[model samples]
Target: MAANKILIVAEHAGGALNPSTAKCVTCARAIEDGEITVAVFATDGSSVAAQAAALQGVTQVLQIDNAANGHPLAAVLAPQIAALADGFTHVFGPSTTFGKDLMPRVAALIDTPQLSDIMAVESAHCFRRPIYAGNAIITVKVPADLKIVATVRTASFEAVADGGAASVEKRDVQVDLPTHTRFVEISAASSDRPDLQTARTVVSGGRALGSADGFRILYSLAEKLGAAVGASRAAVDAGYVPNDMQVGQTGKIISPELYIAVGISGAIQHLTGIKDARTIVAINKDAEAPIFEVADIGLVGDLFALVPELEKQLA
Candidate 1:
């Protein structure tokens, strides 16, 4: 089986680089074991393009800068990315809401097969991914001649070290407009700190916190650890925190290096999102909490008392 070049479809926001994109590049580097070309499609692509160039594995960066492609629709960028994949062995994206929605459409548009959320890439043809809420893992293979699209699980791979310059190439691609779905106002979060799903370290609170204020100590802990604040689905459902902070099967799945679950009982749904953590520490009043099963460290005590003590010690 002859190998081919790897093409990474980078995801990003307006100006900030989605850490997941860098991780996907890392996955692409490890899997393809070939040269890499990163493609960024945005209303303006300079920022993401520059970030891509700084990553070590990237041989070249393509900025698919079409001022009309602001929304996350595949039609806007599929033709461009699929066309870009012409010379590459595989095209990859981060397994994010944006990527999950885009990869399939891009595959269909190009008359190819798409694999969503891979745990590992065995080769260009074979990849492993979790199913049944990560209760089972499945390995799949696609023929090499056919184009393959994959969504890389951000938590499963590390971003390659940043150094060396990348060739920033401008691509002249124009696809038909949607004729609908015009850009509108986007109401974003107001917090100054990094978002939970994208943060490298996350401090999550669960039901044991009792109330919103009961979990304030997590902020202190997060500040000390330079981590983002997260909440379990239970807490978010109860309005103890915003929905954006929820971490669970139905919420955002995060793969941070250090994940601190304070007062969370470790429900299977919640665990699904965080089990990928490199290190898990659970603090729950229940000594029998299910979370302890996967936690590297477990504290059977009230988070109210435990968290403040942790904050003091770490500070």
Candidate 2:
């Protein structure tokens, strides 16, 4: 097989490179004789480009600085990426909101089919992904003749360590960006907690948390451990927390070193989100909860009492 030329779209914010970009580079490295290139699109991507160049497997970095790219609207960036995909064998992005919204547009613009949520690389053209809320794994093969466009499941791959010194090239790509989609103000919940997707440790709550104020217990514990706070879909549905805090098959997928599920009954949809977590600790009164089936440590007790005690002990 010929050397694979892989292009990775870097996801960044506030002039910092998102960790998901490194995971995408790791996925590219799995291909045989692959040459990885990361593209950074921003108003000024020099700093982010430098970070992308430091990824272990990246061969080069392309910095596309344009005022239109100041904000990451898929409509504006997809045309630029498609214009740059002329010779690349594969284009990869993280299966994050940024990538999920952008990669499909890139695939459509380039006239290629996209493979989503790649969990494992079987071969250069064959990959494995989850189905039915991670209850099943399915293998998907792209035609060798077609250019592969995919979204890497960041939770399934470790971020590539930074050790390389790849060169950065500034390119002025010419493409007619769509005017239909304009950048509106982005409203996000502000918190000092670590990001749920990339946090090392996470404390999650379920419908058992009962009310929005009930999440404070997890927040206090999360603060002590420097962990992010998350919630099951049921909790989100019940207005206990915002939708962004949801962690499940329909929500954010996470792979943390330590995952503490409090008051959660461990619905399969919820379990699918944390299946990749290294260590799972379930705190629930019911010993029959399904979360215990996969938990590394199970504490069968009232989370209201156990959680406060655990937080006190961490002090």
Best by TM-score: 2
lDDT tens digits, residue span 1-315, model 1: 327687888878767667788888778776655788888888888888999999987889998877776766766777778777787778888888878877887788778888888888787688899888888899999987887888988768877778949999888875566655555676765776667876878999987677888767888788888899989989988878888888887788888888999988888999999988889998888998899999998888877888889889875
Q: lDDT for each of the candidates?
A: 0.82, 0.95
Cα distance off (Å), candidate 2, residue 170: 0.8
Model 2, span 18-96: residue lDDT tens: 9999999988899998899999999999999999999998989999999999999999999999999989999999999
Error of 2 at 199 (Å): 1.2
Task: Give model 1's clash tally.
Answer: 0
Residue 61, model 2, lDDT: 98
Error of 2 at 17 (Å): 0.4
The reply for model 2, stretches above 4 Å from the true place, is: none
Model 2 TM-score is 0.97
